[model samples]
Target: MPGDSRAATNAATVLRTVLEHGPVARGGIAGLCGLSPAAVSRQTTALLRGGLLRELPGPADGVGRPRIPLDLHTGAVGGPVAAGLHIGVPSSTFSLVDLRGRLLARRAFPHEGRPPAGLSGEIAVGLGRFLAEFDSGRPLLGVGAALGGWIRPDEGTVVHHPVLRWRHKPLGAELSAVLGLPVRVDNHARAVARAEILFGRPEARGSLVHLFIGNVVDAAFGIEGTVHQGPGSAAGDVAHLPVPGSAAPCACGRTGCLQATASDTALGAEAVRRGIVPDPSVPLLVDAAATGDPRADRLLRERARAVGRAAALLLDVFNPALMVVTELSSVLDEGYLEEIRTAATALSHVCDDPRRIVIPHAGPAVLPEAAATVLLSRVFRDPCRSDERARSHPSV
Candidate 1:
């Protein structure tokens, strides 16, 4: 490898080591990441200079300065922050997160009655206001925008989003132009996968599959800590994956598709059709179920089983170390997750251990943290490049 590339890789290694085991000494970082002490020192110096890492006071037992602990600069002041934007069909979420992907503040922006053509502009305006209200003079790294679609992250374009009616839209550039900050765009499925690998379970780094069941249903796969984005970055399109025992009709003239059978949209509509909820809203259905509505609980369980059937197919194919399900009811309630695990384990020939399937570690805060991971992931991969990109953009 080239000299610069090797240095960047070493820098990322050191950064991730500290992220996993922070407030640790330089020698500990070298020991954890298997790098030489000199290399660890070089990267830590650069990271501290870049304001990504900070040095805490050394032990008072007369230990040398080299033994001082270091951690991600997550202090109340001067610590850098990343902005997150999760654009769902019905609403958008804006979040401020620190280096560790912790949510500092968040706001929801509903898109009711907004035209598809002008939706991005409206979101930009609302997001700008959100940032202004939450800005505490911290170093704003940039924005990471995640949504359901065939996204080209490298080009920062939305190749296709059926729900949003977006095609070949330069979403990242538009948002950056309006917000005057660096913006990275990616599919929410992959974003969640990356977030899991970075901040969730340790087993996720070995291998994992993430299934997202929101207004849209999609999946993402990761191996060896890297999420896969196939040709044109459109790998996670599981909307039409067949779900066994489900005969729900899909708009594509197909029946038993995963999205049609298990997505929040389908579940909400089913709840409304059953007179369990007044409107097609997953949250309302969940609320009803929580309030002892048996009808709503049964509907959620039915969708959970359908999601499990689809997850069974994925497990049989990939057999990843972990299978993360990001669904509203399942994340909020363990009963629904148990239903999914039971159904998946029953159907999956390769996976009998229900423990392998779990909800995202962040739970209710999953989308916001995952959206921000779109940019935070880049920062961990190559902090130098991310810093340069942030420097190019106007400070928030």
Candidate 2:
């Protein structure tokens, strides 16, 4: 209920702890968090009264004791309390997710045009529409905008972006004001890395590089379960890594860049070069690949090689513990995918640990949902310092 600071902090921690690792014993939670059993009981009682957590129906293990394993009342915390947004150049997405990261209701729509505010405006509007459409009355603890470009968390601005055209914009502040919710903004790639750390693999907590492949190409670094957001926040802009022999041109006017060599759009452009304007659609490309179209096969394999080369380059420099490559889920063959693994394994120290290089299957959910992971992380990590700043400032 309407508690003060100390109570709030304790309550939040207890709730967060249970949400993170549930079906857990109350005494066990107290011991793990270094809180007294009484303190744990008080917080649990408060949370139970608030309907944020509940005890599952069951008896204790072993002989005749009882252990009503406590859990986040999934019907409540799992149904609401957090919402995620994935913003992009062409479209934006929104979702209501529980503590376990289950999607309750979600919406996707095309951006009308490139607004002066870039994603700031579209995300605000799209989220409003999504909430109204779904009639989701859940408290929106945060709004996370995941998008491309160079985002500097230290400065709280999108330093520069070719895709979003957002430069030095106070994206986090602007949207928080409009949506009336604390917000967390991060690079799409970093979000993918966070997703892997929190949901994908606990081992990825150590040093790792998240090489994300999709309609766009980029990479992010993770250490000790945290994405290495750079001095400003421009850590994963591998798309601009210069390619010595790129045949395709980049949107940034660069003659040779990784994105120019490997992005799906880059592959589709090859069809035009061959004098065939394939219709613009993801399903169309997938259909071609399933039907064994030689051109699609060649494009996919060549693109996989470019991705492999990028991984090798990063491994040479970062020497990360692992590399998780995110790509389209429909991709079932490793025709040249092995070339990437072979390159990472042979050129770097990844051979000893086969888990070093892995491909994470992704679909429309990869880029955007990854963006939301940063928001969820803030609550679990530290109540979101940036979101706290958003709450304090109220305006940029």
Candidate 3:
């Protein structure tokens, strides 16, 4: 691993490799990372000096003879401390966590209005309160803001958040400055996909796709261990896809869009029209379904059919090894998962094993998992190493 400018960044990767899949042997790390023994030793020394990692409290992970192993000191200042925020249509979740993808503290803030500045202020107050009350004296790392709609990751800008009426806002810079922490912002489903990839299950590290059917119905695909963030970061917006027979007008003014037929808005509105639920909150409708309400059951079944169809299309395009879905009601009530399974199975082309589909409940750890994935990107492709290595290459 030779390059242009980021010797330190490459060094960080060496440490992360050991910290992540390490305590492994130095030769193993050098072999996997393509660095010589001397290079690995140099990086390891720098990391130990920085106090980011230390020898494991036990015997080494030696290739032949016993050797001393290395591991990340969880209590290290710069060790973990990443945060993630998921802003939904009506509610937003703010979380603080560590590198191990554990949730230290999290609080959900329900949206009351559409003023960005005021809402930001209130959210800031909430985080400050959390910091004063529970944030350990350890150094704070960066925060990741996860929201719906088209988000430009490199620029840290939100091109459009239809639900929040946020257009061309520097959400990343603004929130980072306000909260006094580094920021990483991206599409909500992508952030959730990050969580699924890193902390959900070991198998998820491979090619996978995550479909989040909630306030925002979006899908993200991870191929060869990397989430495909297409040009302009629009790899997963299938809501505008004109699936036949849906019959509802979407924000794009398209007919039969999936969102019109499959979103919470569609289901809740349909249930309300039939006088089953009073509003467009799908969770409440799901509550009714779980209570044996015939009308709610009917609505859920109909919605599941449409959602499964959308998932089928996604599977055809990505052909991922697994699908991790986060559905609102199904998480709260395990039985509702049967309905989701009915829909997915009715449409999926995944081989005979349904275990390939994992529906996990949303928990506090979801946020940190999202933030860590963003940081984890740099761990895999050290920008610092790439820069320096660029110089090592013969010029064209």
Which of the numbered candidates is closest to the native, going by highest TM-score? Answer: 1
The deviation in Å at residue 172 for candidate 3 is 0.9
Per-candidate clashes, comma-separated: 0, 1, 15
Candidate 2 Cα misplacement greater than 4 A, ranges:
1-20, 30-52, 58-67, 76-79, 112-123, 154-156, 243-256, 275-283, 329-339, 349-354, 361-364, 383-396
Better of 2 and 3 by TM-score: 3
User: Which residue ranges in model 3 land beyond 4 Å of their true spot?
Assistant: 1-35, 60-66, 76-79, 113-117, 243-245, 348-352, 360-368, 375-396
Give candidate 1's TM-score.
0.97
What is residue 329's positional error in candidate 2, in angstroms? Answer: 5.8
Better of 1 and 2 by lDDT: 1
How would you encode candidate 1's per-residue C-alpha lDDT over 172-217 as one tens digit per residue? 9999999988899999999999999999999999999999999989
Candidate 3: C-alpha lDDT: 0.67
- Tens digits of lDDT, candidate 2, 1-396: 335456667776777678667877787678667778888888778777755667776664553212457887666533345667776555677776665565666777677665655456766877877766765555566766666678775554677766666678888778777877777777778887877776665567777888866556778998886688766666788887865445567778877788888766666666557533455443455557668777765666666666767777787777777787876522354544565676556555434454577764333455555666767766556432235564577652
Least accurate 10 contiguous residues by lDDT in model 3: 382-391
lDDT per model vs. reference: 0.93, 0.67, 0.67
Shift in Å, residue 349, candidate 2: 4.8
Q: After superposition on all CA atoms, what RMSD does each candidate show versus the true structure? A: 2.4, 4.6, 4.8
Q: Any idea what lDDT model 2 has?
A: 0.67
